[model samples]
Target: MQLPVEIPGLLNYWIVIVLMMVGFFVVISHGNLVKKIVGLNVFQVSVFVLYITMSKIDGGAAPILDDAIKNYSNPLPHVLILTAIVVGVATTALGLALIVRIRDAYGTIEDDEITNQERDDA
Candidate 1:
């Protein structure tokens, strides 16, 4: 008899889900713009992990063509994930730069505080 939730089998999936939720909650629940940017990065990483996990095959070797190897893990997804990570890093840098500018203009990085300050200025 097997239990519904097998920790060994689903550990990686569960971890990914937890990371995704943490990122989502941080983005939605945080008042700080910098924290939100960090959360977005976290979410991106979880997506990368998911892709990498799906591409991995048990007892599989590298994608290099080899007569000695019958099973090879697909490399396309890993390549895509690498590209996505580069994009994500660039995006996070842009977000941080914007946050710095916002902080300079509003004197606060908190979302609500910035909104209130803008309202008062008008």
Candidate 2:
């Protein structure tokens, strides 16, 4: 008995969609700078998963030259994701550092509180 929709085959896509929506919701609904940064990282991870999912091929082998291997998985997406992971780490670190500075100056990381403080000062 076969199901009309193949849940197993499309599981990765479903996961990506869920993660993307979760990340987007967190980023938009939270006012804390640190939470926003974390949300951005989550979103970035979802995109990484998306690319990796798109690159996968069933029964595919590595791109190494071989006489018998007919289908080879493309390595470009994996390589790009590796680079993106490094960049994401760097960006996260920078974002956190800036948040630290903001906290130091304002004594709080909440966006609304910061704006209110600024208005009070002005």
* Best model per lDDT: 2
Candidate with the greatest TM-score versus the true structure: 1
Tens-digit lDDT string for candidate 2 (1-122): 23466557889999999999999899999999999999999989998999888887876777889898888778899999999999999999999999999999999999999999999999
Residues 1-122 of candidate 1 have per-residue lDDT tens digits of 23466447567788899999999999999999999999998988999989988887766688877798888888999999999999999999999999989988878999999889889889
Itemize residue pairs with steric clashes in candidate 2.
none
**Candidate 2: RMSD to truth:** 4.1
Q: Please report the TM-score between candidate 2 and the true structure.
A: 0.86
Please list the C-alpha lDDT of all candidates, in the order they appear. 0.88, 0.91
- Model 2 stretches with alpha carbons more than 4 Å out: 1-7
lDDT of 1 at 13: 83
Q: What 10-residue stretch in candidate 1 is worst by lDDT?
A: 1-10
